[model samples]
Each structure stands twice: as C-alpha cells, then as structure tokens.
Target: MKKIFIISVLSLMLAVSVFSASKKKYGKEITVKETTKISEIIANPEKFEGKRVLVKGPIVDVCKERGCWIKIGSDKEFESIRFKVEDGVIVFPLDIKGMTAAAEGIVSVKKYSVEELIKSGEEHAKKEGTTFDASTVKEPKIVLQIKGEGARVDGK
Candidate 1:
C-alpha cells in the first residue's frame, strides 16, 4: 500500500511539471488585454477587422507537418481564426493542442477564388491529415485569420 501511494504521488508531481512545461514550450510572452471569442470576431468581422486584439483559448489544431500555424478557439466548431507568424519568426509546436494561449495580431480577411480555395484546402488537408472536399466551395471564400506578431502561452 505504501509503495502504491508513493507511486501515485510521484505520478501526480510529474503530471504537474509536464503541464506547466508544455505551455512554456509553445510561444513567447506578450502583453495582451482580455480574451476575445472567435465567435465574436466571426459575428461582426468588420469591427475587429484590420485591428489588433487579444484572443485566448485552447489549441484545437496545429500544423503537424510544421510548427507554422495554430487554431485557437473554444471548441472544434468555433475554431475560426488561424494564427500564424512569419517564416522562421515564431513556430508553434505540433503538440500544442488543448494548451491555453493568447495571441495578439491584426484580424485579416483574405478573399480567394474557388480554385484558390480548393488548392489551399488540399494543402491544409495534406498537412493536417484530414479530408477536404474542394468542390463544396464553389464561390469565392472570405477567410478570417489572425497574423500574430506576438503570443503568450499560459504556463497553466
């Protein structure tokens, strides 16, 4: 019984350390204001459009192939904005899923034609190991994304 109790205590300690370290490993610290929901941004994109805002949430998806971009939102359904940094500037880890993070950047709206969307979708599908139906997006798509210059990952 003593050995089982000791093992459980050590396991708990290890888990706590890992959780804290995971947040530290992802992004650098940046001063940001209150958290904003992706749904809020999606509701009236023009309000936050071309403006800097603080977005905080769990990472729903990441660039598995490369630490290029991360999807931060409340859940999978609301994973609206894609946060990315410049090449070789900031690289989010592939294992950043479920980690709480804050990103500060200007909200951007990129309009792409059906062909462009299809190609981009295919690339995303290949990188994320998911299936994409490009044909479904027949018209041009106005994509809302956040190009973050700075980020703060809560070492929670």
Candidate 2:
C-alpha cells in the first residue's frame, strides 16, 4: 500500500508538470498582431504602446554600447525605425548588419535625441556594472521601435 501511494503521487506530479509545460508553450505560440506604420508609430506611440508588433526592414545599424536597438527603414522616403530590444531577451548579432529581418515585439514610439540616446547607453552600461567604455556608442535615426519577449530571425 505504501509503494502504491508513492507511485500515485509521483505520477500525479508528473502529469501536472507536463500540463503546465504545455500551457506555457501554447501561451507563447499565440501570435498577437500590433503592426503600425513608421510615421504613425512615431507620431502616436501611445496607440501601440506596450503592444507586440511585427516589423520588417533592413538592419541599418546596431547599438554599439549594447545591442539594445536596431535601426530599420520606414515606408516613407529617407526615413528609418529605431527598435529597442526587450528586457532580458537575447541580443541579435551584428553580423546581420545589412540583411533584412522580420521581428516581433512591443512597440514604443518616443522622441530620443542623440544626447539622450548616448546618455541612455551610458546608464545601461552603468546598470550592468561592468567595466565597459561608453564613448564608442553610436545613435541611429529611429523610426519604428518594437520590443517583446521572443524574436526569431527570419530568412536573410
């Protein structure tokens, strides 16, 4: 009777673990649509604030201080988008420099001046508390920004 009870408890625990794992997977798989135009995205960031969006564009530049933001082009002529990396997500590689990528993330449209961006980079570095140089940080022309939990690299 003792052995049988132990086995039953173990089986119940295993079943619950599997169920919880599946639930998490299903939740992650649920794709949310929150796309917007670069102009609209920047003009009225409040509309799409904190919402996951699908953005596609060429990788103009990657933040040197920390691979936090990726600059993408806008639909409008001579315009670009500046996407900030979501907190705790893996940073994309710089090798993908000129390649076009499709990324999904929450969008935040805010005005960030060059000095502000540099200061932000410095603050981010300081927060990490690592011995890193902030002088090399470069700011890009931002158009549309997307930040989320998961990002899969699409075809080159």
Model 1 earns a TM-score of 0.72
lDDT of 1 by residue, 16-69 (tens): 999976655434556566767878887778888888888878777777656788
Residue 63 lDDT in model 1?
A: 72
lDDT value, candidate 1, whole model: 0.77
Model 2 Cα lDDT, one tens digit per residue, 1-156: 999999999999999999765431211232646545666666667787877777666778877655666777776768677767653354656665676655666776566676776777778768778654556655643434675444444346
Clashing pairs in 2: 80-143, 81-143, 81-144, 82-143, 106-147
Error of 1 at 101 (Å): 0.8
Stretches of candidate 1 exceeding 4 Å from the true structure: 1-29, 75-77, 126-131
Q: Can you give the TM-score per candidate against the true fold?
A: 0.72, 0.51
TM-score of 2: 0.51
- Quote the positional error of residue 109 for candidate 1 in Å: 0.8
- Best lDDT among the predictions, by candidate number: 1
- What lDDT would each prediction earn against the true structure? 0.77, 0.63
